[model samples]
Target: MSRIVLRHQEKRMIWSASSNYNLQPFKIELEQNVPRMLQQVKETDLLGTFHLAGPDAGITLEQLQSLRSQWLSDFDWNKDQAILNKFHHFTAKIETLAIHFIHEKSDRPDAIPLILNHGWPGSFLEFVPVINDLTQAAKASTGQDVSFDVVVPSLPGFAFSSAPPLNWTIDDTARIFNTLMTKVLGYSEYAVHGTDWGSGVAYSLYDNFNTSVRATHLTMAPFLPATPVQLAEMNITLSAEEQFEEDEAMNWNAQGNGYFIEQTTKPNTLGLALYDNPVGSDPRAGTPPSVIDHNEILKEVSLYVLTKSFLTSIYIYWQNPNGFKSSYTKAHTDAPLLFSAFKYNIAFWPAALLQKVGNLVYYRNHDFGGHFAGLDNPPALISDLREIVVYWK
Candidate 1:
């Protein structure tokens, strides 16, 4: 119940319109000898060359080098600042930390309330497209200008939210969000949706605050049992679609999971590299920049760096190492859920797996998109989410 009241000046910063969110007078103090540390990182030769992987792996090294140079020189953080400023923003003191969020209230008093959560390597930006789409759809549907009163909070240590005062877990986050819903927003009940780590938080809220939450929707469902015996016991018959997902998970775990393991056990070490000098060479020795598409890596990395969010985001991983680990074994909710799996993310889990978690009122497997469904296929995702809201009503 500790509250940090914002003065007018602080509120102005928190609620400033997007056009004004620039890093003007940009004076973010780095630790003493930061330039020295950066020099060391740059001299390490960790980022030797660029490599394009996957089907696009055929992209020439020259092309990647050109893109990297352009991003380094031409990309404007101020432009992104303007785009984000268009939304109404605010912050609240909850449990000794300043909680930053974007709150877009629907015109209709009777419209349903919803809370959207984003996962790792992403920020409030992930919800931008869906926010536009859902609000438009709701306005059109009722013909009464009704829409969702959407609240998207940057998880503590993510984006606008305050950095953690100390090590904190996802359970701590769930409690703060629950209070935000009931106390701050004055919503007695609300629907929740999440992707990635956000999915874990959404499910935890459902388990802990079943009465306060109306429905839960998720883009990623890692809690789905992996074994065939477990699947059969849940009355799920693995479809051809589900089988494909199993294969993808197996491949991702084999090839892409080293990062996850490192983050879970020694994130601070990883942070020393990512946070100290994001644009510098990778801390891991002898890794070519070509191993990762520099454009995509830079895009993701720049978002974190410019927002001053790299440390906070990494702290979330550190605080909730168990959140990631426990995601595999968490109990299912009895409440309604809308579970959608993107075809490109087929390596994760298939729609058929929803049965293992809850009474899935709606389930779908989209063939067109990937892991970042809302960003990649906003229209389709919005349509699916709208349908869920209508059906629940």
Candidate 2:
């Protein structure tokens, strides 16, 4: 296969050609001379689980087997590549990096400029399901039709974007993203939404670039939930439902955060270990197949596997060890803030706690959806996006 290779000389020339930002159309093409990734999936030796069954014991052996079987027999990267190409993809040279993003604009003249951000174990691919709907106009409470000129970018060191320096953190990402929207794409002001680490970037944008980031919406907060001691000191109370949510969050911290500690302390080791193994690269196998379609999950896994981004994607965790644990004092923003809480999401922060963080304008709780709200519940996610715009604008 003939690849669209940007040689070292060409890259240097392109970099030195202009100080101004340049946005160019880009596409993902299958690379040549690559080893058969599926063959490695076929060879992975899944370990037996402990006494607990299902996700409690980690990604079940059965789940791994099913995913491996599908990859080896049914998954087609070329077909998926065609689907991805249907969207408008672009790369913008900003600062010292080239950022890859999906820039889908609506035909309507007044469509809102909205930027969606994704987090670890997820990519811009998370928003692929709702891109078209978001572009279509919807009636806001103010009786105006609202649509989005949506932009979803692959964070630095993830997907096709250039890698970040060892000391880089989410703050740097926020600065560059602000430049990407205002400086590169020329959006004077835009609304922002994010989940996971993307929420950190979104919050930073709202906090640091309030003039440029008009409003902010997030599926989760960037800061860690208040500790039990802090909650007691503050005399805050959780309802039964809230307590249940907190318990679930505690369980997740206990069980699901091993990857967090590892990635924070020694990202290089874990990154190198899973770099070439698709099965190992995929950590979502344990999520019940019902929460998100296997095909959708496979799409992300495939992107990480094929693009060779598995190593870089986990760098955020290491780069910002305190990213999620930082105090909420610095999170306050002048921009209106909106939050959508899905019942099945990994963590929960009460409205009382959130008020200290920003100008909380809208907060909704959905009975459906989970961590990957974009994939788990696009309709609810889309509705929330439309509804929140009404409050912020």
**Winner by lDDT:** 2
Q: Predict model 1's lDDT versus the native.
A: 0.62
| Tens-place lDDT digits, model 2, residues 1-393 | 111132233235434442476778898886441246776777776664443477665676676668767777887777878889999998988889999999898876566778999998889988888899999988866776788889999999988898989899999999999888776666666899999999999999988998878888999999897766677788889877677667767777777777878989998888876622222121343343323656666778877877788888888898898998557774545678889987767778877788889988788886666788887778878888887567544
What is the Cα root-mean-square deviation between model 2 and the actual structure?
Answer: 7.5
lDDT of 2 at 115: 93
Q: How many times do residue backbones clash in model 2?
A: 0
For every candidate structure, what is the RMSD over all alpha carbons to the true structure, in angstroms? 8.7, 7.5
Once model 1 is optimally superposed onto the true structure by TM-score, how far is the C-alpha of residue 66 displaced, in angstroms?
4.4
Ten-residue stretch with the least lDDT total in model 1: 276-285
